[model samples]
Target: MPMRTRDSSGRRLATLAVCCAIVVLVLAAVAMPVAGHAYLSDSDPANGDRLEALPETVTLEFSGDGVQVADVTVTGPDGEDVSGDAVIDPDDDRLVSVSLERDDTDADGIYTVDWEILAEDGHTTAGSFFFSVGDEPVDRESVLEAYADDEDDVSIATTAAKGALLLAVVALVGVPVTAAVAVYPVVGRFGVAPSVVDRRLTRVLAGAGVVLFGAVLALGVARSASIGSSGLSLEAIRTFAATPLGHVWLVQLLVAALVATGLLAGVRGSLDRRYWLGSSLAGAVVVQATVSWTSHSATLVDRLQGVTVDFAHVAGAGLWLGGLCVLAAVLPTVLADAEAGDRDRLAADAIRRYSIVALTGVTLALLTGLILAVWHAPTLAHLAETTYGTALSAKVLLVVAALGLGGFTRFVLLRRLDPDRERSALERRVRGRGSSGRGSDGRVRENGGREAGDDPTVDETASTTSTLVTRVLSLEVALLVLVVVLSGLLTSTPTAVVAEQTDAGDPVTLEREYDDGIVELTVGSPSVWGEHGSAFVDEGEPVVFDVTFTSASDGDPLESDRPVTILAHNERADTQLQFDLEATEEPGTYSTVQTLPDPLWWELRVSGSPEGTYVSEWVDVYAVPDGHEHVHEYAPLEETGFTHLLRIGAIVVGITGSLAVAVETVRFGRRQR
Candidate 1:
């Protein structure tokens, strides 16, 4: 093929690849599983309630799976602990309760219920609320004044430890897999005895294993410190090892130790070299899988599917990023030692083989990354508004940059080392194209054999291509490392939905009588925007107004013939919105779903008709707290039948792509052997 034609063809191919990648990402965003740690959903003797009498127990409910009560304490007005140990409900894992202790003089002032919960996904969340036992309404500010709510401090050291652990995991998994799939096979095929290279690789693998082992240990210590303890103590480690997170930590420690031992055994020649290498590679994959289980994926209803996709995502990353580091570290030495006559041939063959592995890695990383992004962030609004979404966006951009660099290396730089084109260069020389006897790649050839430094132009061109490849590779590796660090942060960060839920404090209630001694209305304020209260509802999510009507004369429940409606007016924004209430199974009680438009104070009235038929006095309420501005007008697209199918299809594609790479690796290893 003509030089111009080949160049144009390569460009076209690169463009097509990028377009296909974009389409795949679009498809993967169709619908993702809502996977986040548990958040408080509802509570009995609810927050900010003024009770006629104290209930026997205070129960808390959550919206996530595998919830375990870490701590629950109820303090009386005198600041005395009045609750027994918190126990998970026998029927529902999401529910936990504590029995309250009452005296003859049951405190009439405010009582605070503080709680902490641990989800199986390795995260802890805690919150507090206040309720009173007398007729007087307690100001929220008073509750804050009387009892200082302790905020959980996020340890920076813990975050750093997590990042280090992730880096080590990627390196450990990548080194052996790259050696087996790319380096070993290609060099063997080139008739290059890789004994020296093998020794160096074994040392590298051993070092990675050591790092992995140490990282696992450091992560445990950091985890202990985050839980409010000096992690240096054995008791602290033992305490951490007793929780659900501790169980996973134990598995990680075991895997890291076993993999390190296997690699070391192979290095010392005490074990079957091939057997240990293969075992260690598989162990590395297990470590990667364990890491996924500790992420938000662990909270998914389809936990197995979520973890499988997550594992594939990181494994693919390890293959690509680790392989690049391996190539950059080892390939230079191999090339420098090659015979001058065979250097070009060996370089071409080895790089070409490694290119296939790299392509597979990129493909898996891109596809699975799309699945993971949607799973974690759901909507574009979430991506723009939430911390987790922002980090994910940054990672996606870095991946794209890495992809571009890889494509440039494969199509532009690697093409210069094509061995088959040596004959074509000689043919061109005979045809008098140029006396230089050079190929289109600017490499000199003597009767189908490369001759080093024969032409200054050829030498300079080769030098330039080599320099470009090295620069691109270095940048790509750096970007990928940053991507991994972000991934670690994401694994620890709460999803946007969870963050909103956590921010939403307890519900506030207001009651009023307004019908000339005929009827009464009580409203439990609903907020779609999360503030520092309970019952957090998200924008576009259903905001439930829990209300009841009672006959003032007899103190009996009153049922209205017509459904009740609430009209809310925000004086600040001059916005008026109305919603009709639906009757629940409870008599005289009605609930309605509405979404607040902004976080502003609003006056609400309950009525049965539109024209001044107000049954209750206008009551003041904050639909959403001040300063929490609206970020989006619409909610994320919920899963439809079609989107569900699309999600399933994406998962299948990810799994299939990963399996194809695994098969290729096995084939390469066998052939090289």
Candidate 2:
């Protein structure tokens, strides 16, 4: 009884470990995905808040990992970067702080901060926020508009290059390893061992691998060089050679060299199976580890776990899918000339042997894939709703379908093969269908369409099942290739967890560029932004009309403090409103307590020249009637509530798992006693 109890406990523990590892990884992945995307979390002055005056230091707090401090510019009302000597704190790089050296803080207008940051997840997030000193409340809608994507769209050529590089890396590592582990072993067992043809193929693939890696290396160096420079060139390699990413890229070059060496050894007939496996394994490790450092894994709060899972996932995918490439291409050729009996035996043996390795690889790849998916998307609905999620879902379906075919080949179809028999039933069936025992009758049919694996020549019989299996296998391989393509595309897509909500009402913002920076225009309604129009203010029944300007180029305020004038025209009612807006205490804001005579489509146009260039903006404000006096609620500028739910889920799962372990242990102890 005592021995039995220990064995039971051991089995249970093993089960628990596997289950817990997968569950815990997934929960931890989801736990902090909200912060995985580096975003501006907090600011010293706070967005839309009015400050008494500018402070000596301007600080921005970011939530997430891999926040690269590209630039932190604080534009005062004068449309210039007031943020002096931007620096990241050594202790906490997420905290970007800059000094405000000038007295421009006294100006009454919206003070803007423009930020450009690179998240380690290979994405760039650029945005601007406004805090007022003497001006009206910063119109967030206008600010968002001004800060919209005025920059060029993400480079299409760059994305294609990245995709090619990713494919090359996967094949570079996967092909040699798969060959050593699966292809060579199976083909060698069938007496079609590695030969000069194989060697030549390896040589070509190795050369292609080296060339591909070189392209990737060049791109990496080019990216490093182009970070703050004007363009990409050979000159950038000198600068790139010094950066951490550059160092990692160099390490990848070493790994690529190993891959080439391994392939070359096989090509030269000097390759031991162990040597090829070991070299490919080492190369895979370096490539996986190095890529993970700058990619999605770097953004995870649990860096170690994330990186480990990433390595496993990437390596597993390369092996499983890449191996299929070798199998699909080389399998037919190997079995083409074998006797009917030998062909059936050989095909079944090869597939069944490879199945075990494939199953393991597929399982790890899928589990890790699920873990990544859960991290990037808060819910199943999010996956269905988001493009990234949709792509992932398609990839998952493809994997499942391919795996199903693989299982069929390994189990039902292969198990039925009896190599000892004189002729396999599959070949027999094809022969039975014909007048004579052969693949072709040497006669044209009325339909002019060939039967399954049937030919016009009578000399040889065709096995329909073999052809069917081959076709199925080829389709499965094709789907897996698509899966890799989708994975590459995903590197550029935004996860559902980071997508912003659009329920909040705001105007389409616009931007005007200046020498130092760009200014943003956020449009707001009278109810949310206007002053109390009950007193001395004239024009219609005075509502508060405010114009908030924030600059992304520099944290300077509007250079001119002259009385701001804006003309409001209602084309429908044939009415116009003009306000000579006085400069509020805010540095770059012009405002007056005013309203339109009757609520209609009112166009408010303001023109100003802030240091760099002339700029004009027209904003439309719609005031609806229903016994007015309505105040709008500003959208929360922090993370969505969904992130907090994931946190709650993690806590719940952890507690449950712990309790389960405790309960199991206690039960076992009591039984022993």
Candidate 3:
């Protein structure tokens, strides 16, 4: 093959390899969630069953085999967790019982329990039910739905507040922090001097620091409003300080204060050099910690591992993005300041240092991003199906675009602007600017100054490279900002479905005897039709319910004169979902496939006229919360220290990598010049 063709082949192979790697990551990530059929066979108080009082233990009986219960949260009349530690039946796992903690609530009004289960066969399912006390009629589905409503899921103010906080972090911390810790040091080694860097860099960092501190406060206030029962109120704000979210808020406030103090001390140029650097980096690491702890990682995946990977992701992004901002904002001014012999060397060092930051950033972002995606989205279909998955997909695409742009600049544009070419560009720029070249102190030199005798072409080359860097870095910053914004959305956006589609289990069997031992209902093993099944219904997806009614005396199928239909009532809205059933070839069996409209407890009312009297009987059905938003409502089970090690390792690796790049780039610049 020709040289050009061989190069083309190499590029093709590289691209193919990257594409293949992504496919593998996506495939491997499908975190097969624990799954199995776990439907309600019986409840202690019985759904919609009026009771004079409630039992101490809320017992849930499931007919399915090997059912393990989780997320068994109970809300009483006052909307507090009444369900305490839930335990599965020791002998028969099908019976899950939760002890009630009713210090604040008696057997009054309505009590709702939202529970999920994992089966021995590897299928996970979830549902909710409502129980009434003291003769108050519980509109089964309505009361349960209303009891579990999430105000934050649809709140625009919440989304906007989170987005603002994210943008503020990137601007105030990402850019300025990276500049102070990563960018300025490299330029200073070309004799830019610590004093000069402090003078020029402190103003930006100070302004950004103040903005970040303010943003942290604003984020806290917004969080209180979003998580409160009422939207944007003083009481909500006050109560927020007591929640787990409030705990995160307090941590963030401390980190913000530390960052502000470090920026102030660094800009003063009065602190010990090591102390200044150590304090600033420490503050930055804490910022990443606060972010990781409050982020989706803390709730969505394995807590410690998620936090560690996310910390690396945030740290890398902060440095890389921060460096880009510094370049874009400071480079144009730096290029116009002086036409010196070492100007090209200075530009080269800065570019190489930033390249290293970008390399680390891209690597961290891609690696952590894959883990998060796979944890939340176990399959490709989830990318489109879940809101969180979709937002993350968008972020990944944007990051990739930015990475490609950076690659082009580093490998193509930066390579083209070698020492000779960059010097010529800088020399020409000095002539075109129309001002007498300035001295290193930024004061204008006379027309006959020392720089006036130098080759104009040398100045033009470096100046051209600076301008190119500015333009490319500007675009890169824009993309990075968008990724940050999408990240905010991903954190706030609710998952569309709570149940994981990991294990498609065998059919579920249900039998209910109603109507004075006259009518018997049998829901046979559910079979999946389309995207939904009787075992677990996906929203707006159809499920084929294989239902049959038989006479209690003979244990035979019952024939109805009036048309038989299934009514899935929306309890909140006082509406009903009707699915007309047709008689099957088998005597008493009837089948119908209908779409489940929304995620809520549906009153499954089967009505018909069998022989003489009109017959109507109902059972409660819950298809899980559409999104797994409830997982973070309370603190998760405490994790082991093993997870914390992951985060510590990432923090160490990031700082070490940054220091290595700064040292290497400074040395290389000195050598090359």
Candidate 4:
């Protein structure tokens, strides 16, 4: 009995260790930064600085990871905007140069310089600086421009750094959590010593946590460097350390230490319940806090939603991955033991238990994942067309593969090959045969020693089978880690700065008004130009209708009748308005209003023809806002059709399936003896 127990304990320990290792590796890989073009640093003129002469041009220096800018702009002191011919520096694609037209900037007033650069990450960052030409003095424009520049500078670095940090933490915590829940039942059914398994698992978790913490610190340093900070200062450190997020990181470090201590104690056969609980709670808290900071949990409603979903995601992941670890590590060791019968029973039980837990974990993960995806994405197009959407799709595919593997293990391998009652009967028969005076093929027992070449003992076969299962499960666990890491990356905003560069353009507006029973329209476009044509509204012809209404006792129009109209006109075409008008039936005073079909310049003719005629006003409808140059036309829903619905349905189904599997696994574990 003692020997059998020891073998079981060793197997359990091995299983937990493997599970923890897989989690660590997955999280680390997810945290690794993708190699791409990026802006390493930048130097622009300080805002509100006084210069003796107008510089020939504004120069912007940046490091690109893999992106290039097509143009840059400079708005002069006289409100004359100039765009320099943009070119990549000969030395590096990362560096770009723009040449502004040299104008006499000798006047002593403030000038605004704006730069638009494409980051290697495929996002665009734009900012402006203000400097005084000549030696006049500082003014309101200079101060406002200087302040704006400072705000932009701070925003860019802070947002990027925070985003990166959040991504890292999610990957690190998600993998192990997923694996533990998935394989929990298998680990439990193995009948391995819980103490040994817990000890090894704790050690793995602690060690990995510490390593990840160090990696995070290193990442912070790298981010700072990218932001052009040469050396860390007390203020900088304080800025990071004083925040709620900083406290979370500190807690993570502390939890890692506690986990290490707990593992050490368990290994020494001095495991304390308080220490174990404390470590687990602390570790969980750290993960939770990190999620709050990294996710959209800053707002009250979002916080509630995020916390719930994030917790579910983490817990489900841990249960699946952790259980897998225990199964993989211990199964081989148990199978190698001399007591082959016990090994067989243990392996069978473990597999059964793990299968159930894994199913449940998957189910929960799927459900919560769906909710999160919907909440974050909001629209079907975002899920299918955006970078985040594509990554999510990949994650779903991986999950499906994992689930299929799990199903095969449960239905074919466990249920068919290792039915509990069938295995018990076989064990009884083997024992009876060995106890009886039976030899190979029912012959006399001449030598008395079991024939070495004869049928192997039940225990031996069970151990071998267990070992094989462990190997297979280990592979599954590895794949799961990959999924978790990919998930972390997916949660981040995938639209990079470089991609935003192409989207920069001008603004256009469309406006129409009905006054004194006539429809009038106006269209305006910004002077700025881009590839897209400016927005222009055109109408067919003014359709006239009238509304009659009564005046109130207070002399105000009681029942005012108004019409909708659209007036359309382009720069090269004559403008016209199509109008729909309604008449009011109120007594004492009646009025009529009309609407134009298009937005453009139009004349409204209001007449009580040959009796009471009142002509009241011509209004210009502006199509575009001043200083903007372009507008995006909205595509009707018919254009996209049911593609969006299909995508959304798929996401929902995938998430639901994962949840169902996870729940079933947990119930199976609870029912197991």
Best by TM-score: 1
| Model 3 residue 647 distance off true place after TM-score fit, in angstroms | 19
My TM-score estimates for the predictions, one after another, are 0.70, 0.63, 0.57, 0.52
Candidate 1: clashing pairs of residues: 504-533, 505-533, 505-534, 506-533, 506-534
* Ranked by lDDT, top first: 1, 2, 3, 4
Q: Return the top candidate by lDDT.
A: 1
Model 2 segments more than 4 A misplaced? 1-35, 101-109, 135-158, 200-208, 218-222, 225-243, 261-277, 336-341, 411-468, 501-673
Summing lDDT over every window of 10 consecutive residues in candidate 2, give the lowest-scoring window.
530-539
Candidate 2 residue 149 Cα shift, in angstroms, is: 8.0
TM-score-wise, the better of 2 and 3 is: 2
Q: Candidate 1, after superposition: displacement of residue 380 in Å?
A: 1.6
Q: Report the candidate with higher TM-score, 2 versus 4.
A: 2
Off by over 4 Å in 1: 1-32, 89-91, 142-154, 228-233, 265-272, 422-468, 500-637, 640-673
lDDT string, candidate 1, 1-673, tens digits: 2335433433443344344444554544544556477656557875556678888899987666566435688999888999998888767777888999878476688888877766667566666766778876454244433223223333565566677677777776676666765576556655667775666677777787887888788877766544422335776677678877788889989988998898898788786657666766777788778777767654553556666567767777877888887777677667666664455655555555566556666766767775765566555666788888798889889988888888788777776755345345545664574434556777665555455335444445555665566677778889999999888787777765555434433344456665532433332222233333222333222244656666667766667667788888878878899877777787777776455566546677777522233465565655544334332211233564544554665556555554554554444334333
| lDDT (Cα atoms) of all candidates against the true structure | 0.64, 0.57, 0.56, 0.44
Per-residue lDDT of model 3, residues 94-190, tens digit only? 7888898775346587777777654332233455666667755443233325223221233454455556556655555455455643456555555
Better model by lDDT: candidate 1 vs candidate 4 = 1
